[model samples]
Target chain A: MTSPEERLQAAQQVLASWAGDTQSPEPNRLDVGVAAQNLIAAIEALIGARWGYLSAITGLDLGVEAGQIEVLYHFCEGAAVLTLRVATPRASASVPSVCPLIPSASVFERELVEMMGIQVVGTPDNSRLFLADDWPDDVYPLRKDAVLERGVKEQGNE
Target chain B: MSEAVVQDKKRFVVPIGPQHPALKEPGHFEFTVDGEIVTGATVRLGYAHRGIEKAVESRNWTQSLYLLERICGICSHVHAMTYCLGVEKLAGAEVPPRAQAIRVLVAELERVHSHLLWLGVAAHEAGFDTLFMYSWRDRETVMDLLESFTGNRVNYSANILGGVKCDVTPDLASAILKGVDFLEERSRHYLNVVTTDEVFLQRTRGVGTMSKEVAERLGVVGPTARASGVARDIRIEAPYAAYADFPVQIVLAEAGDLEARFVVRIKELFESYRLIHEVIDKLPPGELQTRMPRKIKAGETISRVEAPRGEAFYFIKSNGSDNPERIKVRTPTLCNMGSVVATAVGHQLADMPMILAGIDPCFSCNDRTVAVRDAAGALVTWESLRQRRLAHQENK
Candidate 1:
């Protein structure tokens, strides 16, 4: 029954313990930067307080130059969107699977593992969701510096 | 996990393909059975993965719009409109109210057509071809209206960067009203059949029931979650486009079974019919297009739109450039797909296909990809795309 603003304020209060740097990108959106270690605790807090449902998990590569891969876990309550931003080193990109907290997160984590080449420790299944089985490992196509071959060849063209 | 007698080390698995006619998409599902009762189930999708998310990172603001539109054949307008709304939100461009109304109008029409298509498919899966045939035949009414109104039927391309492309003319408005009227009556009959038909009810009732607790824990979305009585509709909870101006009530069912899924979707059709009429009758009067900058400012924006199946979420990040830094699309099918695996357990193995269809799962929606031929798929210039299309046509 609370308004979106009230809900968002409540989220800010919930995550106040773990959020490192909080920013309001939009009027209804709250962006909280959390260390990779604190990501789980912050998420547990949100769900524990019944803040909102996890809307999506977005993986971002800050380009080859930045040497950082960022994962955004977005939770939505009404029109309010609260994002938990976690950045990891590109070479050993890893995020503790929130699947332990949110089982549905396994799907998003699987896609992230293959697409962005992030290591999601403790995910139920690390199998490919989009990439082919014989596809080369460690070549994350979504990475800014991924070396993608020409368009997929037709079955006979090979 | 079931009360049914468990056989020692029994793992008789039934695999429904990455290509099977029963479940019409390129998804592989495995169900472990013990004496006709499913013990455990797992689904593997993405056979048709198109690499579109990776492709969007390379394409500039506008080209990505058309690519995102094709994310789902059934809910293409929602994809396009959601992209437009995200891009506009980042660019700080204001879409005209009239254009927003048209966007909602087209979105509601898409919802009606999508629900009808699901009804037919679910009916077919349940071996109720009579209802299937009738529903598919009646679905053409909305299809024809969409084709006439938006030009193409499935991927209508009805949305532009700042606003929508199509407008509701007086002629089109009258035609749409007439079309919805016919659909309203047909939808009522189908609803009655799905709710009351005894034979069909046998397949759907008390089958694959998902309680509200299970629905929330698994994070199922759209009609599937609503059927479980989870009040999680993006349209009502977080109104976007013109949904704010014209609102629709949330549809819910307590049973949380295949029948409830049927009831929830059919009831939604009536809600859509009302929204369509509301948008057309109160068609805002103003310009349809707004100016957008070539290079969008650096920012992060999340746009959540309620697609036919569920909530379609988009996360767009721009590094103050023409091309997006990162674009992530989390379709509703992915959210509800988990529920199928969780609920499929303990049900009769024969009911697997019907339970799968209850969520109206779209594999291609979850498997979005781009046909990249170069370093970054973003180098696909419009001219090259046109040349490729021309070559493809000549080859055909």
Candidate 2:
């Protein structure tokens, strides 16, 4: 029932303590940049206040040139959507798990782990969620330059 | 199959499928059971994961629209519609009011067919074949209307990037009105049958009753959340497409059981029928196609639409080029899948099929036949298997 602007303002206040830089790319959306250390605090703030449901988690590869991956946690309330953005260096891309707070988030976290090769620290399940068993380790399928197949040794009825 | 996944050697865990667990879809579930009662459960999906999100990155704007529509066979229009709305937002393109209304019309038609299909499937799961047969038989009216109107039965490619591709002629409008009139009467009859049928009620009444708190915590969407009083329909709350022009009343049920899910979805059928008639009567006059840029501006946008299942969420990012930089799709089934695992913990194994059908899980939207293997793990040939079955039939 509340307006999208009003909901984003409320979310902005709740996440103010941890947000570094904030931007509104569209009218109904708010993007907040949060440090990796403060990620849980920001998520807890939104969920604690019942701001919205955790909609989806998007893993964006800035590219091989940028050597950084940005993890966006999107939360939607009616018409409003608030995203908590965290950028990690590609070499050491890791974010603390939010599954301790929201159990349903394990699916999203698993996706980030398998697709972007990001280390989701302390997630409840660390197994492969989508990739095949024979899929080589350290090969993330969603990376910008990810090869479809390479280094697959044939097993001749071993 | 192993103690590692279950984490206890003494425990007896029953793995339902990487095959048909209940519905003919491909999802694997492990239900930890003691006697007839289940204690805990886990589900493994992606048996048919097509990886559309990754595939779209290599495609241009126009090409991806067709590819995204293949995400689900049933609710194809919503995917194309969601992508177009996000792309239009990024390009700053304006679609005509008539085009928007047509989009809603096709969307509502798609919803009608989806709900009726779910009704038949749910009935079949409950071992009520008469309802299954009757509902699917009546579903042909909407299916026929869709085929005649949109030119396809399943993937009605009715949407282009800027606007819609189909137009409703006078004859098409009359046909739709007549078709939906029949469907409305059939739907009313179904509502009575589901509410009053004592045998059907026993299978659905109190099974998998999730409280409002659990529903929220699990974060179910669409009819599943609405059945538990979540009040989170994107059509009403956000009003994408022409939903603003023609308002949608959010249907709600507080029981949160399998029966509540049935009732909520059936009630939503009536809402779709009403919207179809409204859009046809107040059909705006304008262009169906709007000019749009091949290269969208550099911006990131989120588009959400209320699909028949729930909120079909698409996040689109353009890099000032023809192709997209990144696109993420989170289907409603992905959001509501967790609830099935959580709710299956305390029910009898016999009730598993109905409880699983309660969510109307669409695993990858692909259909296939079962692969039967013998005791020694050798695959059974279809011809030999068929002949053996025929011989046994004659012997019995």
Candidate 3:
């Protein structure tokens, strides 16, 4: 297996612009912050080059003060994890769906939609995956501002 | 035939459990069928959603470990161990070498129990009740050892924040060795049963066949992908805990059918027994637990562990508080569920149970939310879900 540093360098060469600010916090991990618009391009570059498989997609709420939510697309090969960090304003949070390039992404994208309230633009299927049909609308439980009363009310109705 | 009769052969839907005979767990599945062959499949989960991910946020760093352990009953130790590994990494705490080895030892034993449990379940689905009974009866040997070692059978809670909670005593280690010897012999017989039994082979030899490429494309993990010849084990790839010290052999099967899944799991039992023996023989001597800070430093980290089902991915972000900012759990079943749905299509309705169980699905571990909306964008209730399932069942 190639060194994780070399893998990171190769990933940087694939994305010609804004490749300078990559962070290596732990061993075999490369984290790069990119604009929400460039999230799809960065991921396509990694997948096309056969860098790694999509391990997980984690959405983070920076809270009300920050007013922005971040999405981390983790690509893993062996022990190496190359993460693409994409941030969007929580007011109109949205990200381009990567399902067309990777079909398995539909499940994670649907999760982003329902839990974080982030609209996944162009995802083929956003059907209720693991949630009860009675789960209330506009209340993303994983979101920072998710109300407990809403989830409780929904449960009571059920 | 008549032309009208041919036209009348319309596709109908068959909705299996959120509560059906096919699955022991509670999860809904609707399969569109045409003349006993499945055309499409859809799944609805969250019947067992405990909101653990969200609830963990409200609890403190240490408290969340116990909460996370309850995520899956079968792989509870792995759940806690994975969480502890991530939290420790984020907190900048180092786990002692002996603790790491102990963690690996328990994890391997859990693997034995889980695979045996799966083998029995898959056999039961294939109408091989005798093998089911035999495998499950053999599984208790591992379970008993786990209880004697950790004091609990199902959720051992053996793993703590920094390291493991329980230490392996001389008596316990010898007892485990004796149990391993018994299991190794039984596993060989099981391997022979699945590979050579003519009737069992008929049910699994060609059913749910998946190529290596399809398995990789669907992101299947653990033994499921390994059976298809995809070498994606996390322990081998990223040697966490004591894996770097004592490596385990990777078991592979060429054919990606149900039988391959069986062979891969059965073969893994041999590998686990070998690893367990190695761990006990080289049982390290040191402190079982490590010291930790009350407030974790502000940071985020990813912990990937090869749970019995597959890769249990944990993403933990700490905001310099006692409580975590966010914890995202991407379970293996979530990845393999796509493959199951895809494989279910075009297979005989009778083989659907074996195919779904072949992946060893754990709906409770993979449980999350799905938002079903109406014309006004309102949420659909559980009553409506039951009605929809009933309507489909009535149609059949």
Candidate 4:
């Protein structure tokens, strides 16, 4: 059996144009930094080659000091996990949706937008996923600066 | 026929739940039906959302275990077990082999109960009450064993940070064996019934059939994907904890219909039975708990477990604090919900319940958003409803 690194190497070769600054933080996992413009191209290469299935799109707040939000698109095949890390400015963070290529990615993309407040441009469904229907606009709970009071609607006297 | 009438086909929108009797949980579905055939379908979940993910952020490392376990009452053990494994991995705490074995034992036991519950619910969805009664009655056996072992029927808090809290005694081991023996026989009988029973077969076989390509493309997980012959069992693909020591076999069915899902889950019970017995016979000897630090090292890691529904993915990022920085839990039901929505299209409106139930969805586990009817009496997207709220606030 080929090693996880070798499989990731194959993915890298396919995504040679967009793949940059690859890092293996742990065994059986690979993380690659991809430019936002080429995010879809890199994911297309992985899915096209059947490198793996789109596992989860994890959105991270890099804290206020960093002023950036990191979105990790994890693709898993067997024990191997390949992550495409894309960092966007926290002020106006946005990433293109991979839903056009992978239909299942829509759920995670919607979640990414609603929970982390990062915009997934071109996502078919940009509606609230896990949040209550009455959750306020511009109040994303997962962001470091988000105040819980802003998101919750105050109850009126019946 | 009038020309204006032909253009306006009068497509009726059949709205089901946030509190429908057909569904046990609170999920609103709007199905656009042209006569009996459903043209389009949409689902709104979040009715059961408790913000458990955000709630976990406030609690300390150990306290979050109990909170996370309550995320899903059916597959509670695996939820906490997966969380502990991720936290432990970041903390670099080595759980004892025996603890790992016991954890797997509880996990497999939980799978048995969960799959049996799904069987009962699926049967009920098909209007087969007798089978539902029989399966739930049989499910008590596993539930009883779990209670005896963990002192709780639901939300078995069997796992702690470093290791499992409970140890399997000789009597408990024998009790588990007895339960497995009875379950194995009952599972075989149910399998025969599902595959051969005429009434049940009519409702299941050749109904809600999803091909392998669709299953892969939609990224359906667990038995739902397995029914489509997608070998995506995390336990088999990437064995963790005791699974590496006592591996599990993957169960697959090609038809990808309601029947295939039934068969896949029932067959998995047999596999679970085999694993339970194997683990008991070769139960490792070691301590029950390990010494874990109060504050974990600053790091991030991923943990995937083959939950009864499908693959439960967890991403835990700790920041050298008593509490975790962020814990992202992507339950299997979330991944499988899209498949249910996709499969609902092109099916008879009457068969919608069975098709929805085919994936064995747990709305409580999957709920993160809500849906409501618009003032115009038309189904509206959650976004539009939220926009109305925003507009009202601005005017005020």
Candidate 5:
């Protein structure tokens, strides 16, 4: 079995391949994405020898700047933490759920759905986790340009 | 005779609360009970949601330190410590040795205060007001000591981003040592009361029992997991601050019941005292705070510190700004609350309070609300009705 550092190096190699010129970014972090299906495979391949725990998945709302949504995956192997950033266009921001490979990602994905209006394709139970059932669908509160005053007032009354 | 007369039985529903004497915060739980046993429960929260995460976005790194301190009153220092560590990691600032020692001392002191408060609450839940008063009185000594050192009792706010705001003077260290002595003696007395007292044993021993396997699978931490024979302590696994230098022993138990949790917490008080003494004895002399640069470059870091209740995690993302672009807090109570469902599944209705208190859960942080629901899902307040039933039984 490959050691955790070896696996991390391999993963870094794989990420570097995809990162092209972006490889060897400052702080030794990289941003890359595979197809929704290949995402889990890449993670498994990267997390060799070490137990990879899905730390969290956060959804970033780019609004019109990138005309897309970016989902960040935080993975931890022992003490070493790494981030994998993936973007999907606003028109089609759906991504495959990693719950099959990492069970803890389910709650985070659900939270992303409630907070940023991102769709997690193949989520087992995509019901409301944090937000109430009656919360407006169009309002994504975490977006950079999200209207805070109105959301705060409406939530305050509820 | 039974075959001749079969009647369809209807299910009953009861609502526990959005407000109740049982809960300190407003949250609702609907329980479907089948003749004194809770068959099913659904929890509703967000009643006390203060938009803390959103609020952090607007506040500067310095101002946000105070905001995070209020996330939960019990583990205030832990919140500040974790937040400070995250920002420190981002800014590449290293805390001084003396500051780290002081931070560890305060953190352990906070744990003692929190555990003592928990004991009092647990005693109060069991209708033992005398024990409750004694425990709280002892707990006040630690709080007074904290006030003497930091100038505030609850929030403390002693931690800055790179280091601590307050320094422990020689006089303050002596006073803390004296306070620890008093707490150690009183804690021993309290332990005896909890262990040998017939009433406490009867009320807690087998009630809300969580098996080792169940506790592990649910990812329970701190006393709740320790009581179930799981040796998972973030302090031991990943030590930050002075913990990395002076390693403290992790307390564990095997029973996994309310009694076991009580023991683990009580034992932890002694461990905290030992740790505080260790930190104070090996006090180093150096600068308190390190100078952090004006701007933090775009980076993400995950930090975990062992809070009084369990492992508390902070994830901070900086976008080359003075303020954090994103901040996420994962309190231990959130993980420990899952085991409550499993433990309380078969417990008696009367044992609910003690069982719920066993985890020493910070529901205020966990977003918990209690609502009593009957089998058919109707809301009801059982306290008044239970009192009426008692009166009727007394008359009969």
Candidate 6:
């Protein structure tokens, strides 16, 4: 059986070949978007269903300085957790939803949509998860600029 | 009296509640009932949504620990442990061996409390108030033990960024052992009552049955999945904290019913006692916590810790700031809630409470509201006349 480090190395090697980038020992800081797609394909091909668990999906907003959105995919290979990072520019912050590949990704994507306001292209259920039905379309509380104090009207009120 | 009754009646929609006596939490569940048997059920959540994920963003890293701890009062320590693990991973901090051992001990203690609490709630749903009182009385022992160690019972914010905030002295360890001993003796009696009590058994056994395959596909975790024979305990599979050194056995069952889930959790209480004793015996000698840097470097780290409920996950993204760039938490209840819908499908209307409690549903931690949709896909709300009638009348 290959060690976690060995498996990670093999994954990076395949990704480096596919993306035509210099193979580095650390794949933690890899760029997001296209590079992420290549890495995802590499992992799916190498590990297959053995690493089928999409444990969680996390998104982070890097303000105007970087103007980027950081998305992390936490996957489990048996007991070991391997995280894949993908960074996207804030202006066109979009990433392919992995729910089609992993059904568990659906909830995580819903959370990401409500929290970070990032567009998950082709997600089947993009409905509001933790927000009120009457909540304004443009408001997302997790974003840096989202207003927290704007309360919704009581149920009985018109 | 000889009038012919109309047999072919149309199905009527009944909304359970955003606030119903059957459900402890505030979330609406609409069931399409044909007399007593339910044809279809749709759940609407988010009534208790306080925007926790959004609240975490505004707080600093240290302050978030307290905020996260409040995610669920029952599994408070678990939330703190997961959040601290995330920050520690991002900062590349290694906890001391003693700290790890204490963490495992406290975590297992919390598990005992959570399971006992669920058992009480399950008993209440079955209308077995005697069992509810007994389970809660036994649960007080664990809470007292926690309070002795961490200064509080519910939100024992014992976990810090690098390691635990409090240390277990010899006296505290002795106190914990005494509590464990008491719980062990009481648990045997509770187990007998849970398994052999006729009414309890009748209400739970074969009711809310979720097949192993459906449980897996729905991603159910903790005892709910274990009862269905999934064997997916995070503690046994991925041992973090002191669990890696002193492994705790994962209790499992194949029955896939409310009774099976109850048995699995009851057995886990004994396992937790054994683990606490093992940790106390092998308590390592080292510093409690490692010093974390003031600023975290630009990097990302994801960590998974076995919370009392199941798998509690945290992913942290740091941008060389005092505050985190992003922090995401995937709670165990979120995974278990999916199974509620699958298991409740064919169950009778009267059995809804037991089925709902079988998953040990924690909507506060899961944070998703219920929205009722009609057969034609039209959204329905309390303003609908059908909902008002159900609220006023007790009988169908």
The better candidate by DockQ, 3 or 4, is 3
What stretches of model 1 exceed 4 Å from their correct place?
A150-158, B1-10, B369-385, B388-396
lDDT of 6 by residue, B348-374 (tens): 877987888887878788772234456
- Candidate 6, TM-score vs. the true structure? 0.83
Report how far off residue B375 is in candidate 1 (Å): 25
Docking class of 6: acceptable
lDDT tens per residue, model 1, A1-158: 67777888999999999988889989889989999999889999998999888878888998778999999999988889999999999999999999989999888999999999999988999998878886789689889888765343331232
Ranking 1 against 4 by DockQ, winner: 1
Measured on C-alpha atoms, candidate 1 has an lDDT of 0.88
Tens digit of lDDT per residue, candidate 1, span B1-396?
Answer: 112333447567777776752557788887888878988988787788988888887788898998888888889999999889998999999999999989999999999999999999999999999988998898899899999988998999999898877877889899999989998999899989999999999999999999999999999999999999999888898889988899989999999999999999999999999999899888889999999999999998989899999999999888998998888999999999999899988899889889888999898898974443446434454467788899999999
Clashing pairs in 2: B17-B28
User: What's the lDDT for all of these models?
Assistant: 0.88, 0.88, 0.87, 0.86, 0.73, 0.75
Show where candidate 2 strays beyond 4 Å: A150-158, B1-8, B365-396
Superposing all C-alpha atoms, what RMSD in Å does each candidate have to the true structure? 4.1, 7.6, 7.9, 7.7, 10.5, 9.5
Candidate 6 lDDT, A117-141, residue by residue in tens: 8889877678766778887787766
Alpha-carbon TM-score of each model against the true structure: 0.94, 0.92, 0.92, 0.91, 0.82, 0.83
Summed backbone clashes in each candidate are 7, 1, 4, 3, 23, 8
Task: Identify the candidate with maximal DockQ.
Answer: 1
Candidate 4: RMSD to truth: 7.7
What candidate 5 gets wrong by more than 4 Å, as runs, is A1-35, A38-57, A62-64, A67-78, A82-92, A95-110, A121-135, A149-158, B1-10, B367-396
Q: Residue B40 CA error for candidate 2 (Å)?
A: 1.0
List the candidate 3 regions with Cα displacement exceeding 4 Å.
Answer: A18-21, A151-158, B1-10, B368-396
Better of 1 and 3 by DockQ: 1
DockQ of each: 0.53, 0.44, 0.48, 0.44, 0.19, 0.28
- Model 2 over residues B110-209: C-alpha lDDT tens digits? 9999999999999998999999999999999989999998899988999998899899999999999999989999999999999999999999999999
